[model samples]
Target: MNLTLASGAPRPSQTFRTVFPVLALCWLAVFFDGMDVNIYGAVMPHMLDDSGLGLTPASAGTIGSWTTFGMLIGALTAGNLTDWLGRRLMLVASVTLFSVGSAVCAVAGGVALFGFGRFVSGLGLGGLMPLCLAMVMEFAPPRRAALTTGLLMTSYHFGGMAATGLGLTLAQAAGWRWVFWAGVLPAVIAVPLLLKLLPESPGVLLARGEREKADAV
Candidate 1:
């Protein structure tokens, strides 16, 4: 069955009507991805101040590097996996992995645990960026692809702003743990919505030879 346009027209021009919702969803997910990615930096000062973490300046820097390293691995592996797994599943998995990492940070007893949590989260975090970009790019109309790419990138800044806002407001009142807990909120909110609403990438379906399914979009 063919998808109807929002105006109830039978899929007309393969223009904004087909693309806007997909872009919006990817934009929001990328926004949260940005927020989650930056939350560590935003809370670093508080983490250092806690004293309980026993994080020296040198070690702190090393931990940051480790998290980045984790992200690098995650990105590479997830990119390859996306071809086999499909975009929607990878996005959901990425969100879930990071959310669990946030929770792990919330209850972490030491720097090691916190760093490990960040690393685990990084794996999911790294995968999300390219996946979202690719999905949006593939689905966006030819003339609009570049514009959509820019739009998706903008969500990173928006997510960073949100993380900064949370750090300023919640970290002061409730403690850094609360900030991490807040990070988990995206998993709760975004994961279900993504699984339920985000459409499968048509390219992915077409590659799997599910032409009927792809055209149904």
Candidate 2:
């Protein structure tokens, strides 16, 4: 039986109504960000085994730092641009940029190229979390906002686990490049829905003087 709370909200079974459509889309977007973050780690051993690439442990660490560095810059930059570009557009751009980076890594012929790809992917990965969290908080019912945020965050860990699973099962059989190629899947899966359904942040609209649009959103 459906249960009711003292505050008049339904129990867990009925909390689905508290979730907005954008929550699912943002969750998917964040999932890919996690996967892209870990894809290189998942396939690093295999990549290192190839003699032609000449990836020493020292160099690998440096390359890994590049990704992290890109993310640092991306987060700071995206944070400032949130007001100007709006959440939905920035989120789409972040996903698309990383997917393109993953594609570049998938086709790269050498260590330098792969490192560059990782850096590019990191840039997008960095910016997606704040955007996703902002959207989730904006849409969640006031009473359940905290729970919805926690749920959204779990998707990141799950995405990382999925990357590890893919590496264990398919990286060797399909090749390392295939692992990076898989990173592009999020753009294909999430971009269309986000473009069609995700709404801009009300705060952003109000800041830009679109009071009517902000109220409607």
Candidate 3:
């Protein structure tokens, strides 16, 4: 199917049709990303209360700083790496890395291990935001790019809400570990959908010298 704009150009309606699936996938992924990123914060109070974890307020602050530091490195590296690797691969890698980190957190026996897990997860979390934003912007109608970006960002808050809800309910009952387990669920749900539905950026395909694939999009 084709859609016509005011300029009388014959554009593919299906061009934007791909937008719904991709956007939904990106939204869910970002939502999970947000929940994972905030899970530590959401459960910090309980973590500190657990004497076995040996977490103090000062140590907690230090760990938070370390996670942020790791995120900075992740974002910078992923920006350059995305150019070399395709978006879909990077997205999958990011989701996988973060999910592993969440599992590590769920099973962590010491503060050191938990900190390390958060730092590792930070890398994936930091990398995902820009990539999703870029994809949404590129796929959206030119005039609606700003709106699309805004809409994409709302997923983060939704994820945060989910995290908050989980922290309130599960953290009190099953404990903080369960909250971390919840963080890992996104990887299970999102990675497969991304692999199946999210198409490679046409521009990226063209740049990689896959002209036919680019044009086929």
lDDT for each residue of candidate 1 in 80-165, tens digit (9 for 90 to 100): 78789899999999988888988998999898898898898888888889888888887777667889899889999999999999
TM-score, per-candidate, Cα-based:
0.91, 0.90, 0.94
Model 3 misplaced regions, further than 4 Å:
1-12
**How well does model 3 score by local distance difference test?**
0.86
On lDDT, the candidate that comes out on top is 3
Alpha carbon lDDT of residue 43, candidate 1? 82
Winner on TM-score (1 vs 3) = 3
Candidate with maximal TM-score:
3
Error of 1 at 40 (Å): 1.3
* Candidate 3 per-residue lDDT over residues 61-176, each given as its tens digit: 98898889878988999878887898888999899889999999899989999999998899999899988988787777776678878888999999888888888989999999
Model 1 worst lDDT window (10 residues): 1-10
Model 1, residue 80: C-alpha shift (Å):
2.3
Native-vs-model 2 lDDT? 0.85
